[model samples]
Target: MSADIQKLGEVDRMIHEPARLMVVALLSAVKEADFQYLHRSTGLSKGNLSVHLSKLEEAGYVAIKKTFRGKYPLTICRLTERGREVLENYRKVIRAAL
Candidate 1:
């Protein structure tokens, strides 16, 4: 193959995976979303969603916050500035490949 294609192959494996990509894509559109909202949107199980969120958080691609909404604790998710730039670059690379 070519150097260009090889570079494309280097797409961030973490974000390239389908499930995680969906999670990032969904979060990219909104200001922030709660756990339940992501659960319903991604159709991923609670456990699965939690795991993905943790990975993203660790990557510094997302910021997860726990806050109290009255008597209940709410978990909110949002892509960080760096995350947004990465997502956009991913899109560019994929589009360029096509």
Candidate 2:
């Protein structure tokens, strides 16, 4: 196998998954987004979104914050510094391959 193939194998699986990729990609572009916004943007069910968020959180790729907007609760998500670097590196690998 070529070195490029091995590099592909080294890709971060956490963000490699399509759904989680979407979540991270969205977070990359924004300062932060709330649960409802992600739900609407990704069109993922609440449970599915929560699951992906949990995985990203576990990987230290994203920060999840719980707060209250008046009488309602809000769950906000944002990319961490590590996450930004990871995403940028991922892009670099892809671009190099191309």
Each candidate's clash count: 0, 0
Off by over 4 Å in 1: 2-4
Residue 70, model 1: lDDT of: 98
RMSD in Å for all candidates: 1.3, 1.2
After the best TM-score superposition of candidate 1, give how far the Cα of residue 2 lies from its true spot, in angstroms: 4.9
Listed in order, each prediction's TM-score against the native is 0.92, 0.93
What's the lDDT for all of these models? 0.92, 0.92
Per-residue lDDT over 1-97 for candidate 2, one digit per residue giving the tens place of the 0 to 100 score: 6676568877888898999999999999999999999999999999999999999999999999999999999999999999999999887777666
- Candidate 1: residue 13 Cα off by (Å): 0.8
Tens-digit lDDT string for candidate 1 (14-76): 899898999999999999999999999999999999999999999999999999899988899
Count of backbone collisions in candidate 2: 0
Candidate 1 Cα deviation (angstroms), residue 11: 0.5
